[model samples]
Target chain A: MPEAFLILILFQLVGSALQTVLHLPVPGPVIGMFLLAAALLWKRSRTRTDKPASSFDSPALSSLSRSLIACLGLLFVPAGVGLVTQMPVLLANGLPIAVALFGSTLLGLMVTAFVMHKATRDRPSPERIPDTGGQVL
Target chain B: MQSLSHTLHQIYARFLPEPNMETLFWLSVTLAVFALGVRLQIRLGRAPWANPVLFAIAFVALGLLITETPYGTYFQSVKIINFLLGPATVALAIPLADSIRLVTRSLPAMTLALLAGSITSVVSGVLLVLLLGGSHDVALSMAPKAVTTPIAIAITTQIGGIPALTAAFAILGGIIAAMIGETTLRRLGITDWRAHGLAAGIAGSGIAAAQVAQRDPVGAAFAALGIGLNGLVTAIIVPLILYFLPG
Candidate 1:
């Protein structure tokens, strides 16, 4: 159980370290998750070919996975509590703060949309009507 | 004598000087708090403005009050949550990576858009605050209101804004952005999940994705990407901007 826990965190650490170093637009956690998934996939593949004609796989990892899934939401508690400790500051700066936040979302949406549209402009939309052969050129 | 004894019990309960538990203690408490967060969401679906983070805040306070636990005792155990947060935050990279094809294809537009989004958010916030004659601290914090917590706090501190104040405002900003996001996107005629998610991630961070996940999982996934990547960008860019912005 402890081994699995350590493995889970180690991949996350690697992902973050890489993100910091590479300056990828991608987040570290996403990378870590991918790495973890890759590792798990690799392990599964390895076990499939080794003494697996009639061997049963380990149940411990499944239980551990279930525990982690169950505890997922709890991870945000500290930051959430940190919010309460800072309320006085919030009430004082509410309006301008609101403007900044809402405004940013709008701006980001516009820019991201423009970017996405431009990127995929050449690729036909999936919703486009297809020809007889199901091709939508 | 009986009444006096009862009063003494109350006093003892309220003012006990002690640390109840260590790291494991706090981690479990945090997990339980998050469980309550899930409960709050389930109880208040449809008009789903109920934020888990907000519930978490209330939960900790209530726990402290009911258990007669001191802040120090709670914090000692709570540090585990903080420690794990760093890794959990790093884990966000997984969702972000899933969008690599979109990212490489749209690099220029995304770059320009990120630059525009970051600058505009800061500029507009500052301008509005100046127009309102808000305090220097208030104005400073508002500048980074759209960014992630780490970047927001840095910008706030550098520009002579209060760091703590910036964090709180960031949360408020995230909640507000998450709230109006879907309706605003539809009204703007923007149907792309990538775009919507990008916007939510940049402006709302994790809080926004949590909300986005309910209505659109794909968008939420992309939003997670946008949050982590752009958070890193904002962290680096905003601080540098402050560094060279004439003081």
Candidate 2:
């Protein structure tokens, strides 16, 4: 239905608007995302009848969300093209920047992983959570 | 178009958009740009360094040169794709939701990490510029280079680094992260997949996310989560901190 597409676009519009209007340092789509989540959860919250929660967690809905998730890969195409534009610059800065990038990323990972691994180690593994599932992409 | 001086007039004339052909022609280039990207990914071995984004960009620049289209003219339409990038970035929230609990629990450490990451890049960027005698805006833009593009762009915009330039630098950071971040992590003996992925996301954004996913989905997913959260976190924190910091 047009409503679904509109919902998606509407979220984006609101997100963009917030970026331009409020100057939220946070990305507008992110704002729009929370807004959309609120709406979805709100709609989800209202249906408290004997009607099972099945509709809320419908396979159809999950499939749609899954595709949107998949489109995350598609979104890279444009940026990737943009990447090619900077090849000359990249080549020039390649060695030093590579050092910085890899070094920083490694350092960031060590710190995050160290803290997280320790924190989650004692807790029941995420696998125990019903919907936590297998953490596969 | 064959005549040298006439080519200039022809380009200017095309700018006027006299007929439907010109519009269609530009549309074709845009589509080709997207197609070339997909095609290269499928056709090649799909090596990380030989990424689709890199290929499309090279093709587009070469195409522009061959067609003799001015970079400005080509950008007129490509800008549409650029504009859509904002919403695509916002779409990252989908993945972010999956990690909300983890983020909430670890907010302090995560914030500390993000702040550290931002400071590392900003100080280095500005220092590099000052040391090299680059423009102040370049220094300002480079500050957020470690963060993903959208947040990086906003921070750059606020501090007056050219957004496009910042976008380029952010991608460079991601590529470098993708290329060898793993090696460093291995050398450091950080063996947890989740931590590695988180690091990849923090430093590399989506590119690193995809790279990490290729090796380990759990780590990749976490990386994606980190990318979104850090993008948001840095977007907010960097601007506020930069506001008080001596520029």
Best by lDDT: 2
Give TM-score values for chain A, per-prediction: 0.52, 0.73
lDDT of 1 by residue, B8-121 (tens): 547645664344634555566666676676676666752346766566767776665555555666666676655564455433433444456666765676676666666666
Backbone collisions counted per model: 12, 2
lDDT of 1 by residue, A47-87 (tens): 64655422112344444444443343455455445554555
Off by over 4 Å in 1: A1-76, A83-88, A114-137, B1-18, B21-30, B62-73, B148-163, B244-247
| Top-DockQ candidate index | 2
What TM-score, to 2 decimal places, does chain A of model 1 have? 0.52
Cα error, candidate 2, residue A120 (Å)? 5.1
User: Compared with the true structure, what per-residue lDDT tens digits does model 2 show for residues A25-83?
Assistant: 66666677666655555665676657765443344444445555444433333344444
lDDT of 2 by residue, B73-106 (tens): 6665555565655555544554555456556665
After aligning candidate 2 to the native by TM-score, how far in Å is the CA of B220 from where it should be?
3.0
Instruction: Considering the two chains of model 2, state its CAPRI-style docking category.
Output: acceptable
